[model samples]
Target: MFVDIHCHLDAVKNASEKIALAEKENVSLIVSNSVDIKSMEKNISLSKRFPIVKVALGIHPSEALSMNEKEIEKAFSFMEKNLKKAIAVGETGLDFKHAVTEKRRELQRELFKRHISLALEFNKPVIVHSRNARKECINILSEMNAEKVLLHWFLGSKKLLFEAIENDWLYSIGPSVFENPAVQKFALLSPLKNMALETDSPVLFNGKPAEPQWIPRIAKKIAKLKKTPLKKVETVTTNNAFRLLGLQQKG
Candidate 1:
């Protein structure tokens, strides 16, 4: 079974249709992440409606720094109240590329650490939303002794990727493999055991938005890069994703 390890189903208008298409393509599961409280609820509701959908609840990096203490507390409360309904804590991390103020960036980093602590406390996986702050994110994850860290749409330096590999942290690659040379090189150099497939849908790639069904294409690209067979790549990626997301392997 195929799994898109990171996606935002809440951002799509025809999300159900997309999920149905994934099912049709033998994509047995999808791990949908959220950007904030509203989207977290939306993701949870979507997961409830579809048995194959799993949820990761947390605020996005861009939204994280903007949250006041009361708002942050409210999110924490809500998460504690609904912990059983979600599978992970994330789409949360530092983003230096977008936030305008140093203060906001600092707040975002603080929130990232909070989320990391929460994930460790819960013993749940985290989906990190690292953009240009890869070193800081990696350092924070290491300092926090965070287990089950999944870097979504990971586009860090080769050194950081190697660090993640050394630590056995998971990395998710999206459809960017079709055109992005750096991402392609990362795939080529990465062992299949350390990587999994994802499509951050509604996020444009190469001037076109991605779809969940493009996971197979991503896998095919990986196979070509790794000089392995498509089926082998598909099988290993599926297993890696299942293990990362804590899903049982099918008989």
Candidate 2:
């Protein structure tokens, strides 16, 4: 079984069809994340309709950049109320790469700090999205003693990547591993024990949106990078996903 740890299923036009395709491919689980309350609602429905779908509800960094104080409060409050229905506390973290203004960037940081606090409060893992501000995000998480962190679509300096690994943080890579030298190097040199795979569906892959069915190929690439067998990659990554999400299998 394979798991795509982070994907915006709600953003996809044919999300239901993608879910069916994933099951046929033996991609057993997908942790669908939300960008806002509306997407969270759709994500909740997806999880219900397809048992393989799990959820991570939170506002995106770019979305948070435009939110006002009241809207942010309402979003967090809703999360506090509905966290039980989800597995993780994120899709949150700083994104200086996209937010572009110091003021809005500051706002992003503040909101991200709130998310980290809430994740600490709820004792749930945070699925992070850090772009240009990887070091800043790592600093905030470290200062807060965030115990369960997963940096999805991670792209940053190798030094920072190693720092995150040293802190025992998990990183999720996707199909970009083939094209992005940073992702390739990160997946290649980083310990497989601390690594996992994601499709980030609706994300373009050679001009088309990617899907969960592509997880096996990406996993194979990572395995080859590490000079490890396919099963080891599958086992280690699957175990890591279940551990970070605190998922349990029932007979």
Candidate 3:
């Protein structure tokens, strides 16, 4: 069975149908991450309704840029109250691509730190989104001494990637791997034990929204890049997902 370690199930159109399709494709678990308070609540409800759905509650960096202090606090409060329901703390990290101003960057960093702290407090892995700010994100994560880290759709410099690998962080390979040679290179460079699969559903890929059912295809791509057996890729990545997210595998 496969596991989608990161996705936005609440944002997907016809979410129920897509989830059923994923199940038919042997996707046993989908860790849906929240980008805002509303998504957090929706994902929580989705998890209760579907056994395969799990949640990771946090504020996205881009979302944080627009939120006022009061709103940010509200999100943090909600996450703390519902942290027990989340398998991880994420969709959180630095996104300098959108955080244009220095002040905005600082805000993102502070919020990211708080999310990491909360994850540590609860002993949950952190699924991060570090776009155009990989260095700062990695530095902050290292400063926090975070042990369980998953860099979702990671695209960093080779030196930084090596640093993360040295830290033993897991990277989630998404469907874009099929089209993006950089992503394919990432898959090849990353050790099988340090890799997991994600769809990041609702994100566009080749002009279509990705879904959890794309996981097997992503795994196949990784297998081809790594020159490993398809079954081995599936087994290792699925095990990596369960281990990092603290989920129990079904027999």
- TM-score each candidate: 0.95, 0.96, 0.98
Q: What is the lDDT of residue 50 in candidate 3?
A: 98
- Residue 62 of model 3 has an lDDT of 97
Give the runs in model 1 whose Cα sits over 4 Å from its true position: none
Cα shift from native, residue 47, model 3 (Å): 0.1
By lDDT, rank the candidates, best first.
3, 2, 1
Give, for candidate 3, the lowest lDDT window spanning 10 residues: 242-251
Clashing pairs in 1: none
Predictions in order: lDDT: 0.86, 0.88, 0.92
Residues 97-123, model 2: lDDT tens digits: 788988888888888988888888888
lDDT of 1 at 80: 71
Q: With candidate 2 superimposed using the best TM-score fit, by how many Å does residue 163's alpha carbon deviate from the native?
A: 2.0
Q: Give the TM-score of candidate 3.
A: 0.98
lDDT for 79 (candidate 3): 96
Write candidate 1's Cα lDDT for 146-213 as tens digits. 87989888877889988998888999888989888988988888788878889988788767677788
Candidate 3 lDDT: 0.92
Which residue runs of candidate 3 sit more than 4 Å off their true CA positions? none
